[model samples]
Each structure stands twice: as structure tokens, then as C-alpha cells.
Target: MFTATPSHNGYSKTQSLLHESFWLDNPERPSAKSPVNQDIEVDLVVIGAGFTGLWSALEAAIENPNWKIVVLEGDRIACGATGRNGGFVSASLTHGFSNGLSRWPEEMTELLRMGSQNLEEMGDRISQLDIKCDWLVSGEIDVATQEYQADELQQVHSEMNKLGVSAQYFTAEEIRARIDSPIYQGALFDPQVAVVDPARLAWGLARELERMGVKIFEHSKVIELQDSGTLVRAKVGAHWVSGRLVVLATNAYPPLLKRLKHLIVPVYDYVLVTEPLTSEQRKSIGWLNREGVGDSGNQFHYYRITEDGRILFGGYDAHYHGKAGVKPEFDTDPDSFARLADHFVQTFPQLAEVNFTHGWGGAIDTCSRFSAFWGKAHGGKTVYVAGFTGLGVGASRFAALTSLDLLQGRETPRTKLRMVRTKPLPFPPEPFRSWVIAWTTKSLQKADRENGKRNLWLRLLDSLGLGFDS
Candidate 1:
């Protein structure tokens, strides 16, 4: 392989917080994740070195102090979406209760309630562990750029009341008072969310897990999983790690299991951080408090304020890599980076023409349901978690706990959301993939527009499953 060009789809170290100005940087005191070739064995082998694997290893080791747990990473620590994300601790409620109830056959409301609880627990964990990832507890504002979105919010709000969910709805006047923008028709604010320095959180957890006795191997990629009872043989650079239990935490990488190949769609989410704004400029935007936000359309933008004065913003990008994933785009590519920066400036007139200091992208696993899919692999010996559906921050937090619960032979809240399974997106690879991805993306976008409009005709499309998934 051409290692000379570097891992073509790898993280751009140059654009990381490690190199960002004004503003960049602690991880959770993680052990150095750059360890070289080595062989080691443990009771559990966790694959994919990101938030899920880190937390899984940490929790398992903490529960059984004597058991050896190892985390296998294909690339550097936090190099995945954990390091390159928009940093929002988003909840599963974003898909709305109606969609959840319709798509997920059982306990949709409870699933969302538990989803909120997960965010609360994450807040408590960060506070108790004192893992400083610039944790900011704030509301996430979903604004309607067009009249259609405003209607969708109203309908969702009505549904929330039906479900007895607690949320605050705002009028266009209220939105304007908070931020000077006419583009927004109305907004919904969910307080059960926040932003975090994801890399710092991952690193800190990894370090803590190692200290708690988990044996972590850096260049370790689980090449294959053996189905001999609970025993699994995983491969590293020069090691074959055999363990009593194998937890496949690989979210968006080439799947370790064949059944999962087309199950997870690798959507490329991109992010860009701006150079710190002047104090006055920060106040001018009125988001000076650093609340995270995402738009209310089918395709929307997400933005958050860094601890410093800079704003990080990003959203949908073309993924060209594989069946469900985007092909890798370079960090310095003007097409990708500049396009994102342009969106940021256009969204906020006050910060027009601001230069972005960093740009990066990473693949995230999504299913047709826009939710996670997890269950047994290899006749129940190997367990896995995947299909985060673009809200991995909070979902990953819950995934760790679920993985442990299943390992301990107990039931999890996922049992409530279990009806959500990984189904093919109406086609196979090749032509099927291209059409499905494009049509689904387009259909969802149009459906979102219709919901935003509250147009009867648009609602008809959604009901017919004409534009979006049922």
C-alpha cells in the first residue's frame, strides 16, 4: 500500500486543537496512545479506539479490576469523529417523538426519556471525574430558516406535549431577541444538551481506563474475530490478542463482521474552527455565552462557540469513500474547507468574511433510522455497537453502558429501542447505493422543508414515504 501518501482518509494533525491558536488544548490524562508493536492478552478486547471503545474498556476494567481489557485503535487516539466532531452532546429526541414512535415500534417516549438521562449522566461523569473537556452545559437551539421549518417545530412541539416531554418553544420574536437574524422563523430549545472537547474527553477516559488496569494497545486493529465460545483472537501490528470476550466498538471503519458491511452508512461530517473573534465582535453575535446550535431543515448546519472566542461550524458534505461513506477529502482542499467557511459567514452576517483557522472531517455511522444499531455478532460471543446515525456523542455514551449491561447478561434501555434494526437502505451496493444515498438525502431535505412549511401537500409526501423514510 502507498503509505507514502499517508493514510489518505486520515485526520489532518496540522488542523487539530494540538495546533490551533488561542485556544487549543488537555485530554483526560490518557496514557500515550502512540505505543508501537507489542503483544498482550486480556479478558476483554475492545476494537476501534474512539469514545465507545475507550469508555467500554474503562467501564469493564473498573467493574472487574482483575480482568485485562485492551483497546485496539487503527489510527491515533481521537483521530476519528471523537476528535473531529462539532462537539455537541446531542440527544436522540432530535428525530422527534412522532418519528421515533413510528419508526421504533416500542417505548419511543421512554427511549427518548432515557436518551436525556444519558446526557445527564455524561454531565455527572465529567463533573465527578473532573475530566476537563471544556464541558459547557447549555441549550441547543434548532431554528427554522424557512416558514416550513417553523411549522415542523410547531407540530413537533404539539407531539412533545402529547408525549409529556418537557421543552421550550420560542416565537420568531423571541429568536430575533436572542440573535439578530431574519432567516429564522421560530425555534425550539432543548436544554438537555451541551458541547465538549471530544478529544480531551476521549484521551482522559483512555488514561483513566489504563490507570484502572486496562491494557491499551495503540496500533491495534482487530483484523478478525474468532467465534470460539467467548474467546476471540484479534490482530495488532505484531500481536494476536486473544481474550475471553470481544467488544467490537468499531463504528465507521470497515466492519469486523461481514453482516455489518452494508448495515452502517458512513456519512462524512465536516467541521471548521475560526480564529478567535474580538471581544466586541463576540458580543455582537449574542451567542457570546457559547450555546451550540443546529438549523431546523432536512439538511442543516451546526455551530458552537469554543472556550476561546472562535466559532466551530459544519454540516453535510459529500461522502465518496464506500457504499455508505464519503470518499476521503483532504483538509487543505479548498472545495471542502472554503465551502464550509462560506456557510459559516453567510449564516452570521456579523462575522462575515472571518477566516477559519482549522478544517477537518471524519466519517460517522448512520442507519436508515438515524439511530444506532447494536446486537450479537458471531453467535453471541462477540458484541458490537454501531450505526450511531450522526448523533454519536450521547449515543456512544449510552452504547458503552449498554455493551457492559449485555456483557453482564442484563437488559438495557436499548431493549426498549430494540425495534430499530439495521436494514439495507432499499438497495444493495453499486447503483443501489448511489441512488439510495442521493434520493434519501434529497427526500429527507424536501420532507424537512415540507414539515417546516406545515404544508398539507408536504405532509402528504412524508405520509406516503415519498420524500423521507416512514
Candidate 2:
């Protein structure tokens, strides 16, 4: 096993990098659409123009070509979590097999099938639409950094084989040959996950929606949502727009529905992107396939190489503000960035002179179960999907389909799954919620340092099917 001395020092080189997301800083980003300025009516009005909402509008429009669809975004398209993530697109709808088996053992088989189909269909859609978003289906490697984590991965590999899932277990030497990271003790490689340019994907989808005659409005925040019996009315500034049906894809932000406040909390996740490596620097580390990599720990780190050869490293400190609100001020955390920089150097010491070009953070819609859940409000006319935790890049497409199924009152195979029908356990209110999260974070850090041994509080939470994670 590899070990290193931990330090709390900050990297002065990171101070010169841009604070914006590297993906969203592209010059190809489309111009924003005009805000909703006049009273309008449509067959469907989708809220929050992130991946989920955009997919919902596209799916619904294709299902019924004559229907008029309108999408309202509080900010520009792809400005939220969709634009600020590590961009690892996973094929697991329940986060991963372990979480799925632990939570929904009976329905895991079908859920896995659907999740695979969703990913395949996503690839097809990208090709058919001809969207050039640096799409790569190179898969992912979950590296074990500790002895206990290696043991856990070995067990997981065995279980996955029994379940007929495609996976390969790599020894420490084997893993080092692939990534050349001293921190890896071993690795579990799954060939289903993909990494993409998330902002480009979101922007490309928005363009497709426009091409299909769907109306999109940006910079139009919905101040209030009311049911008018005949339709749902949304108040956007001086405009009052009504729709026969509505879908809420607003994750992490303050939900229009009060009940969602208890179900979703905005956990801030930070990320750093290095400048493109020189040929010599790249040869020093052998990442031949450029597969996305993540360390196996309670507080893990995920890193992937962008199409431009920059390394996007993120995760490890999931912070929950006291009040749990999403704001611009939370987008930049110097302390978290410094911690990530220190960890990066520890993993790849040969790249000690490398410098990051971008650093940023975003709010993930975290729930107790750490997966997406479904709900409907306004007497079932308004369907909402939230609580994607941190793995929403690919799962958001599945969530979009489920939200449409809920809206149309269709009982398809997806809507019939227990994972789709059930809601995560609500978090406690205020000070108690903060205290529990704080205590859980401390316990998780302790477990990571203590050979993955669960303490009393963590054991109790695991027994009760309740805990906090990102």
C-alpha cells in the first residue's frame, strides 16, 4: 500500500486560475433566449432547463408532435450542476450495484436492465442528433487506496460476477500500470460508465429542442406556482404563463413545492481542472485509455482527462451549509480547492510542477438514499423529480422519462419500479438536521481513517437505512 504525509498547506499557483467552470467557458455556448415577457399558454411547461428538464421537453415533444412545449430556466442553460460536475456519466440508476442491492434487492435486476438501456439510447441520441460534445465511452475505474477498500472491491468484483455484470479486478501493480498513481492499492474496472463534455451536451440538447419547435426562455425565474383548476399557472416576473401540465426539474435549488424542502439538501461539491499536459508530462503518466478514475473511500475523489488533455479532479469534501440554500457565494471555496490540490499532488507526485487552470463548485441535490426519487404535486398535474445526489449526468435522462411517465399517467415498466415509486426519507428540520449531518460527516471521515470500521452512530444510521453522503 502507498502512504504519504498529509498537510494543510495551500497552493499559490491555483490563485491565478479562473473561478468559472472549464466546460462552460467555451466560446461555442449559444446565446441566451429572451425571458418570458407576456402571458402565454402551452401544453407543457417544464421548470429548470438543466439536463432533466431539457430531456423531458424533448421526449414529450417527440411523443406528441403537435403539443406546444415551453421551458423556463432561472439562469442560462447548463449554468447549474449540469455545467459544474466531474462529468462522469454512470449507467447505474441507483447510484451503483451495491447501493441498489442494499436498498432494492428484489427490483435490482430490472433496474439494471433499464439503466443499461438508458445509456445505450443516450449514445444513439447523441449520434442521431450529430452533437459534437467530446463523447467518450471509455468506462471508469474505481481504485482502492487502502487495504480495507481493496478487500471491499474484491468482494464487489465477486458479487458482480455472480450477478453477470461485466467487471475486472486489477492488482496494485496492474492498476499502477494503467494510471501510474501511487495512491492506488487495487482497482475495480467497470466498462459501462462514460465521460463527456457536460456543458456541450446540455447546450446541444437545448439547440435540438429549439429545432423541434419547443420554446425556451432564460433568465426567467418562476416566483410562484399556482393551480388554476383548469391548468397550472406560473408567475415569472410580470408574466403569467399557464400550462396543462408541468414538470419540475429544479434540483438543489429551492423547490417551488414546500414538501421538497425536506427531501433535498444542497451539498456543495468543488472541482479543479489542470492545464493541458505537455507530451513529456503526459508520457510520465500512462493513462492510455483515458478512463475516468475514482478512489474508493467514504470521501472519495473522481478524476478524468478532458478531451483537451486537462485533468478534472473533484469530490472529497461535501459541505452542507447551515440553512441549506443555493447561492452564487457558495460557488468558490478556497479551502476546499487547496485540499484538492494537496491531494492531487499526493496521488501523482511526478506532476508536482503542474498547475490547475480552473476551480469551481456547485450544489448537488442530496438525499438520504443517495438516488433520484419521484413525486407529484398540485393534485398530480405537476410532476417533479429530484434527489440525484452527485450522480445525475446519465441518470438524469432516466429521471426525465420517469417524470414524463408520471405526468401522462402512464404505467410503463420504468414507472412501475420501486425505485421510481418511492421517495427518500425526509431530512429533519434545521439545527437537528445540521447536527446530524455534521456528526455523520465526522463519523465517515473516522471510518475512512480507521480501516472502514463503522462506529456506533454510523452503524445505527446504516441499520435504520438513513445516513448522509455525496
Candidate 3:
């Protein structure tokens, strides 16, 4: 919707950027787990081995050591959004404070507390399990490149202070001192966020689950799930596996359940990673803390320094293909990569010589509310969680635990929350879905360009509490 023709000259020099994730391109990636070979029965069966599935398996295994857990993956672990994200582990379970406040004003305090606890527990797990995934609690800084955004950040800073959340507002000069980006007008720093090597985190979780005696099968796609009397039968290739309980952790893919089609849409998000910065190059940009940086725009860009000093820049253009399905070919979009590269140079003119070494894209499970929702099927024997939008790196753990609670019929603090008890407005089918998405995308783009002024269509969507984002 926000179309910007990229300059062919700058991108031409980096035409052959690798199509793999920088976090996943390591030589230490774990070998694939064996696929399901024969009929099997387990206490619990988990589908889709991303963060949600891995965390669900890990939590279930820890809760009941004797419960035989089996995880099925269509491909290798972390090969989806788990591997191809900007890796900003955030504690905001409702996407962000503003979104949380707007959606659940009454339960925001509890949600915030739970989100913070989730992040703390994640840190504890990483330490306790010795998962060396470059877990840096470096926090995040949201910068404003426009005057209107700067005013908005100031208001957000005040609101956060009132809400008892620790935050700091930086002036243009102050923010430029922290990260020498010429485009920065102001910034808000939140200390509860972290950046990590996402692929390593996924791999560590998989290894720990295996250590806990959970059997994980790679290349074993669950073609069909039939709800039998007391068990759910899943067809995986030539094998049929039955389980007492099933968890559907598949996000943004062609779901095994038809109900999920209306609740989730695969919005492709693009990213580009620059080669590791030299000492002098890093010094030039004064990012001493290496906190994750995101622009304050409807169409925003999230950039961060990887553990290896490379800058992973992503976001802005969320592409939705017709039919809204995730495919391998959608992972690399030349135009999106070029636009990102161009923006990177605009943000930091001093780094114009730095060429991107990797460019890739991943599908985000976007819902109307821009947060996750939970549901059950097959008479409560099966549970599913999806629509993480774009902030599931940390919240997936919470979703996993909550899904487990739902499947086991346990009432906990997380399960009692209204956010979990409700579902987002389902998207209409087919042509209407595509038209609404395109119109909303265009409106969001217009808002960003017009000093954040919402159009009538966006206002109507806001009134109805229905909108789309990635």
C-alpha cells in the first residue's frame, strides 16, 4: 500500500544476499529429529515445533515427567518465524502498553505483571538450562523520526510513568548520543525487552525437551487430525499417531483445523542483516548498550545488533499474498529487501557503505486484535493457540503454559484473564478478506505519511475494535 520504488543502484551491489536467517546460518545448528515411522500412542501430541510447540512440550514434560509427549514438525526446528525473526524478546503480552491499555483497560495491570513475570521466568529457564543463545537483556529504544511521533512518545512516556512502568524519554540529542542515527527526533527506552539468537533458543528448547524424554519428529506433517472417542488420531505421512491430548501450535501455516482459517492470516514480514560491524564502524554509531531499536511508526522498522555485531533490520512492509498462505517463495522479496536496505542507509548515512549480507522474510500470524487467542476442540481434548501477530518470541511461553492449563482443565491466573477467555473477531472469507486487508494496509500507510492521522476507514475499524497488522 505504501509503495516506494527502491533505488536500483544501491541494491544492485548486494543482489546476491543470502536467503537464510543470520541466527540460523550457524554451523552449530542441531541435526533434524527422526520422523514418525509407525503408529504410536502418547500421553500428549504437539504439532508444529516452533517456539509455541517447544515451550508447550517442555512445560508439559516438566509438569508430568511420566506423560509421554510427542512433537511433530513439518520441517526442521526454528525453520519458521522462530528462526527468521528480529529476535526482540519483549515482555508486553498485549503487543505493547498502548495496545494493552486500549484493549483490556481493566486487566492491563495484571497483564503487565504477568508479561514481566513471563520474561523473568524465560531468563531463569535460559540460565537454569544453560541455553547459550546470546541472551542479552539490553532493553529497547523506540525512536521517533517525525515531530508528531516525538510528541506521541512524550505522551507514552507520561502514561508509562503513571502506570508504574520504568521508562525514560530521550531528546533528539540524548537519543543520538545513545545511537547516532541522524533520523532520530526522540526516543523512549523500555528495559524489559531483550534480544537473542532465536534459532539457538529454539534448538536449546528442543534439546532440553529431548532430554526430558519427549520424542520430536521432524518432516512429519500432521495431514489430518480426527477426533476419536477419547483420543485424537493424527495422520503423519504413512503413520497414524494417537494421543490423549493434542496441542496445535502451528501459526500462520495451513492449519489442520478449518476454524483457524478465519482467525489467522499469514502476513509476510521482510528483514535484512548487515555484516558484522568493525570496531571503528561500531564506534561510529555509539550503540554501547546494543539495545534493540524500533521506529515509532505504524509502518515501523525494528533493528538490532546481533551477538556477532551484525545489524538485523526488518519490518515496515507486511505483504499478504492472495489466498494468504505461507510458501517458500514468499521468504525472499527483492523489492522489500531493497526498500529495507534503502531505509537502513537513510537511517544511518554514515553506514552507507555497509552492504546487507542476508535478506529474508517470515509469515506472522496476525489477528484482528494483534495478540494471541486460545481455543479448544474435540470436546476439550485438543487445544490451539495462534495469532501472535509479531511479538511471540517471549509471549509464546505464556501461551504455551496457558494452552497446557486449558488442555488439562486447570484454572490459573493466566487462564482467568479476559484476554485469554475471548477470541478476536474472525476475518470474513475470500474477496472481502483480501479487500479489507488491502484497504486497511493502505489506510495505515496513509496514517504514517500524514503525521499519524487516521482515515475514516481506520476510525471505523477502531470503533469496531477490528484491525489488521503484522
Candidate 4:
């Protein structure tokens, strides 16, 4: 297992860094829209301007061109997890093939098809709309660093083959020949992943939504939602936006609904991006295809190459601050940055001298099921979805479509799936929540060290189909 010690070889490289999401640090980022200043009435009111909210508004606008849609965001567009991710838009609605198969075996085949189609449509939408956010169908490689992980990945490859999923299993030498990482014991390559400039994608979506006549208001946080006869009214500070239907796409932030409080917990994930690699530096790693890469560990690291030749490294530490909630103060973690830098060097010692330029963190809306779930409230006038668990980039579009189906009372293939119909097991409230998370995290780390052997705690979680991840 990779060491989490802060004093490792690459610690000092994290000293000088821009503490912000690399995707959001762009001169081309669109300016914020006006905030809601007065009571407004619309056919639909979508809360949150992240990918889900934007996609909700976009899809709704495309389906009903005459309907008036308003989007309210607490901060700038994509300022939340939408802009703060590794940008690996995977075609996996259920996190991954294994997780989906384990949780919803009966619907796994259909789910896989839908997820792939969703990704294809998403790419088509981006292309047709001319939204240039570096959309690359570069695929993703899940590398096994340990011998046991290699065996497990090989087993997964065989299962995927039986399921008719197109994937390639590579031996250590074969995998290393592609990426040139010494620790790669084996790899499973899934050609259904894409990487993008996530913040750019969100901004472009917002732009197109506005072009389609969707009213978006940034810095307008919906504090309260109430049922008023037929319409649902959401309070945004001193203002209110009432609509016949309301869609809550507020991921990771405090849910407007009371039941969502225990259903999802905000788990923080950190990231670091290096300065653009020199030609020589890039050649040393031999990652020419720019496929997104992740290690096969309970506490794994996902790293990908940027368009400009830099590497974005993240994952490993899924930190939960209990009842602290989501705060800006938690955006930068020194220990996490140090550990990531150390691991970055450990993975590619040939690029040990590469200096990181950016470091940031964002909270993931983690549920026990480790995938997205939907719910309805306010007498079915409002529908909400959350718990993408860090794989929401591509899934958010599918989530938006599913949420819309639920909101509009449509019985589509998406809404009929058990994965969409069922909600994850609610976490035990408060203090126990913290205790359970701490214990689970410790056990996961121990499993990583012990060749992926599950302890009693993890075994029980597996039995219940409930666990935590980032």
C-alpha cells in the first residue's frame, strides 16, 4: 500500500501551490449572473448551478422550449464539486461495472447500455452546441499496484467479458509498456471514459441554457422550500422563486429536505495538479494516449493528463469532518497535499522533479450505496437526487434526465430501474455517523495494507450492500 506519511520524498514539492481548482482557474470562465432580488414565478425552478442543475435546466428547456426555467446557485456556476473534480467523465451510472453488478445485477446490462448512451449523447450535445471543453473519449485504465489487486482485476476482466463489456486486461509488462509505471502489476482498460475541462463544460452549459431562455441566478442560495397550494416556493435570501415543479441538484451542500440529512454525508476529496510537463518530462512517463488512470486499492488514487501536458492527481484521502458540514476552510489540507505529492512521485519516479502548481479539495455527496439515488417530497411537487460519490461528472447528465422523469411523473426506462427506485440505507445519525466513518476508513486502509482482505466490519457492510467511498 502507498504510504500516507507526510514526510515522504515528494512532500516539499507541495510548498508552493495555487490553492484552487485547476479547472476553475481559467481566464475564460464566464462572469456570474445576477442574483435573485425579488419574487419570481417560473414553470420550473432548479436549485444549484452545478452540472446536475445546469443539465436539468438544459434538458428541460430542450424538451419544453416554451416552459420558463430558472436556476438558482449559491455561488458561481460550477463553483462546487462540478468544477472541483478530476474531470474523468466515466460512462458508469453505478460508479463502475463491478459496483453496479454487485448492487443491481438484474438491471446491470440495461444500466450499462444507458450509461454508455448517456455519455455518447453528452458528447454529441457538447459537439452540436460547440462547447469546447477538451472532450476526449480517451478511456480509463484501472491499474493494479499489488499482486492481489492484479488477480482481482483479472477476475473482473473475465466477469466483464462474460457480461459482453468490451475491455482489455494487461499483464504487468503489457501495462507498464503503455504507461511505464513500475508498480503496475496489471491493468483493466475500459474504453467508456472521457476527460474534460469540467468548469468549462459547466460554463458552456450555462451559456447554452441561457441562450435557450433559462434564467440563471448566481449567488442566490435557496434557504427554504415550501408547498404553496399547487406551486412550490423556494426562498432565496430575501427573494422567492415559485414554480409548479422544483428540482434540487444541490450536491454536497446541506440538503433543503430534512430526510436527506442522514441519507448523504459530505466526504472531502483533495487534488493536486502539476505544472505543464516539459517535452522530456512527458516522454519519461510514456502516457501518450492521455487516458485517465486510477489504482486498484480500497483507498485509491486517480490521476489523469491535462490537455496542455500537466498531470492532475487526486483521491486516496476521503476525509469526513463529521457535523462540521461543508466549509471553505476545509478546501485546503496540507497533509493531504503532502501525501498526494509523495504518492505522485512514488507512482512515476521518472517525473520526481515535476512541481505541482495547484491544490484544492471538494466534498462528495457520499451515500452507503456508493451511487446516486433519487427521492421526492413536498407532495411530489419537488424531486431531488444526490450521492454521486465523486463519479457525478458524466452521471450528472443521466441523473438530470432521471430526476426530470421523476419530476414530470414519466415512467421511462431510467425511472423504472431498481437503482433509481431504491434509496441507499440511511447512515446512523450524528455521533455514530462520525464513529462509523472513522472506523470504516481505518478498516479500508488496513485492507489496502493486508492485500485487500476484508475485516468483519467491511464484511458486514458488504453483506448489507452499504459502505463508504470517494
TM-score leader: 4
Ranking by TM-score: 4, 3, 2, 1
Could you tell me which residue pairs clash in candidate 3?
none
Angstrom error of the Cα, residue 392, model 3: value is 0.3
Candidate 2 residue 121 Cα shift, in angstroms, is 0.3
The predicted structure with the larger lDDT, 2 or 3, is 3
lDDT of 4 at 162: 88
Report the C-alpha lDDT of model 2 over 1-470, residue by residue, as the tens digit: 21223344445756777999999999998987899989999999999999999999989998989999999999999899999988899999988889888999898888888888999999899989998988899999999999889999999999889878899999999999988988789999999998999999999999999999999999999999999997999999999889999999999999999999999899999999999998888888899888999998889999999999988999998999978389899999887888888888888888888999999999999999999999998888899999989999999999999999899899999999999889989999998999999999999988888999999999999998887878
Q: Which runs in model 4 stand beyond 4 Å of their true positions?
A: none
What is the lDDT for 465 in model 3? 92
Worst 10 residues of 4 by lDDT: 3-12
Query: How does each model score on lDDT?
Result: 0.67, 0.91, 0.93, 0.94
User: Which regions in candidate 2 have their CA more than 4 angstroms from the true location?
Assistant: 1-9
* Number of backbone collisions per candidate: 11, 0, 0, 0
Per-prediction CA RMSD (Å): 6.2, 1.5, 1.2, 0.8
**What's model 4's TM-score?**
0.99
Q: Which structure is stronger by lDDT: 2 or 4?
A: 4
